[model samples]
Target: MSIAGLLIRRERLARAWSQEGLCRGICGTSYLSKIEQGKAAASEEVLALLFARLGLSWTDDADGALHAQTEACMEALFGGDAPAFAAAFARLRAQERTLLCSPCAADYLLLREFACEADGERRPLDAEFVSFLDQRQLALQRVLEGRHEEAALLYPAAAIRLWQGAHLYARGRYAAATEALRAAYDAAAAEGYAHIMMNCRVYLGNCCSDSGDPKRMQQHYAVAQRLAEALGDQKILSTIRYNDAATKIECGDFAAAYAYFSALEETDAMSLHKLAVCCEALGRRDEALTALARAEAMLPEGEAHAPERQMLALVRCRLETPDYLHDERYGTLLTDCFALLRRERGAGYARFHLKWMLKWYKANRRYREACALLEDFPAEK
Candidate 1:
């Protein structure tokens, strides 16, 4: 059925009006019924009249202005101008009925979904709207759902390879992610899509960081920072700063990393956890415990946080005990940490933790446990 017809019928029913009452001065009841059933299309004049009688606005885009605005909306989205996109979207939403009944309804729906995602809102798509999504959008939906392998199969075009790289990164496949992100970066550069180029650079930086290539990581982050600054996107800039601090930690610059992490305005659970790590590294045991406590309080009690809780427990064990190296609870927590890291398939994190675990095993003369841990998690190529 036509969207207008469906909306008209729904609105009529909502107002408890019969077909005869709705079409009394607009058209014959049978004609109105046919239109509502999708067997006939109403003339523009009749459509305008029926909507006016029902106290709804009807716009047929006679001047092509609405179509131009639709294109502008998409351009803003692709250009990463969140403010511009928000304004354009507001204008389009004000003409919601007209846009939904227009030929560009699919585009409208796609824009709406992207907007919702940017706002961190997750809701099921309408069946009809889902049918309108192309491979890229479908792949993005899969990526958001953590189905990286399935999403990879759907991203054949270079334009959407960024999403493929992002999903692969989420799966801890740094090598594959770097390759995909580099290709995506070239494509974005060719297309002059600054937003996409910035995102590709950020992911490339992360891949390099995970692979222990600090030089290349810094280079990518430099480009990303420049692009983010040019685009005026504070969110991406904040992400770059957070990642830079993490790389500092990997480089053993605990004081610098601590200062950087401490300056960030974000107090989310993950950020607090990172702050705790920095504090511990700097030997600020009291401050570290405080940060850890705040982080633990922010986490909800559930299986969803089981792995994170396990990691936090290890940190706390190290903090609360003077002889954590000889503590049985520390050994148990480390064992659980390894198990959860394996289950989560976080190769990057596992590699980092494995180094510390091996050092502990060797110092304690636990050669067998070290060998078993190495066997379970081979070094990444």
Candidate 2:
């Protein structure tokens, strides 16, 4: 440990202090432990008190604690040396802590990010909206730093449930995701946090789709679409529409599924995939390939890559149409499928889907391919 770290520790111990002792009015013992162990950083107010508790001069600018964080936030809102609007908005948020619960916190966060983005106003919107966004920025900081649980502050109701469900889904815990998302939906139904509710519903639909619970997926999309319509949120409505398209495709409503996606201004990945699936269902092999290509193009690069893209790649390789042929292009599709099958990390429908694919190949007189797939599949217990 550095001398400063050692001094802090010695002074704390000399006072017969526990990590919990330092956290009395500020945070939790576990929180303090992480800080003292260098796994976390202490807030300025806590550090000021720590010095005072050690009978030392408390001569420090308290904002000094969050100074770097504020600077980084500004940089995020304004990267260039140009004037930063986010700084002013951030200052307002910091100065008026009461702004935390304001209705426009969302707008403030948007502005703050925009300030970094454009280094100027991006759009002509209302002042109330900006103020609300400022509060949201502060809330995000607290949440990211693990202070949400400490302060008992919550996310925007819709975002809260959406994130909770998303987190559970990432952990392969679908049941928990369903419960969290449903709570969020229910809460929104009463109070109308429409945009957030739509996001939550989007995530809920995704979970249900993977679980093969198409009914829940359809229901979520319906409710989300209704909420989006009420809010006049076209973007989210597009998402819900695309999800509904996927559900339609699953229900074997190929014509309706195609029409649904064709109507959307901005179709999502699942929509593209579903559109492709519709083409396959209609025996339009060329169109199906194009839709699959479109879906692949829509897959975001790097870590944000959607898992469904992998699944779709798998389908392209193994899923056969009498109209389709085995060639180098088909080989690429097969390779993509194998990669997807190898990386099927989630439970429930993943293995089941692969099993069904294998069965489909065999039933179609593709014995060689079925044997090849069986070679890679886990031996049945």
Candidate 3:
């Protein structure tokens, strides 16, 4: 039974129409009663006919309804309900043609983009999309750089600012993203949009980590943690915990980070891979090797987690092959790995591989390579 069914039943009874009267020439009385009770699904034509008889619209506001549906789809994805997510996605695709003129069309597209990215199946941005993003980013930057108080007044919705911040963060514009995210957070807080506020805080915390502000990162994480707790959303709680562990690594708190990683229930390949890196950093070679093996086992059989495979192989080779940096085989492999990381993922991910490479370079007195790696960050405007 859906909320729509309840609404339809309530409205039908309020009009004092018997099931036989409502269904007279359109459907059987049993069918109408079943539809009212949610035991049978009503086709679009049936709903339209019934609503017309009741002097009401079948879809009150299609745009808002579509947006709500999209949000429901996203919620399923976040909760890891694959079957529900698939059904919702199929429904959205089927309704796309009807929703073409919807005011929330852009929002639906953005949500789809987010869905793809989360699944690690993101498509390359077209030139037009890139151009649109560039313009929005420029506008967000201007807002952040100029008036502090007029940001919310300038944007039509506070949530748009959060989207801008997320875009900036994904593109490695951490400082700008941090500012935009903070502004979004404050506006969401003022408006009592608790979900948006919590999300802003989480992303702001991540951006702070990327921008080298551990204090700000911790502050944002603390607030987001409380929000996640109060909201009682497992997805939000898991995301916050994952980011907290990753931030611990960024802060060089390897032991604490390892503890956090080890405590996780669902040991995904990424977490195991990170835990292996932590073990390697702490000079626990045996533990690192075991973790790497577990990570590899956790990875899907074929055509999935390619980057993790490359990384795991590289990590294993580096561990076993003495003078790995000096070896020509590993040297070429490292170059190929670096190229793949940069091209396939982004600067954020490439940095992880570079971190280990830089450490090895420094250890082996390859200061020139180490320095060059250090300078490989995306150039700021």
Better of 1 and 3 by TM-score: 1
Q: Which regions of candidate 1 are displaced past 4 Å?
A: 1-62, 93-98, 117-159, 263-267, 297-310, 323-381
lDDT of each: 0.76, 0.56, 0.67
Name the lDDT value of residue 116 in candidate 2. Answer: 41
TM-score, one value per model: 0.71, 0.48, 0.62
lDDT by residue (213-320, candidate 3, tens digit) is 778878988898898788775787788888778767766898988988877778887888888878877888998899899988988866556766887888788888
Encode model 1's per-residue lDDT on 1-381: one tens digit a residue.
345565577678889999999999789999998877666888888888887888886677788887798999977775555678889999888977778666456567667776774423544354434444566566645545555557667864443577778767756677788888888788778878788899999988988887778889899999999999998889899999888887787677879889887887667777787788889988998998998898899899988678778777878888988887787778878877877876774666666567658867886889998998777554333
For candidate 1, give the lDDT of residue 143. 49
- At residue 148, what lDDT does model 2 achieve? 38
> Which residue runs of candidate 2 sit more than 4 Å off their true CA positions?
1-161, 170-172, 186-194, 205-216, 263-270, 292-381
Give the top-scoring candidate (TM-score): 1
Most lDDT-accurate candidate: 1
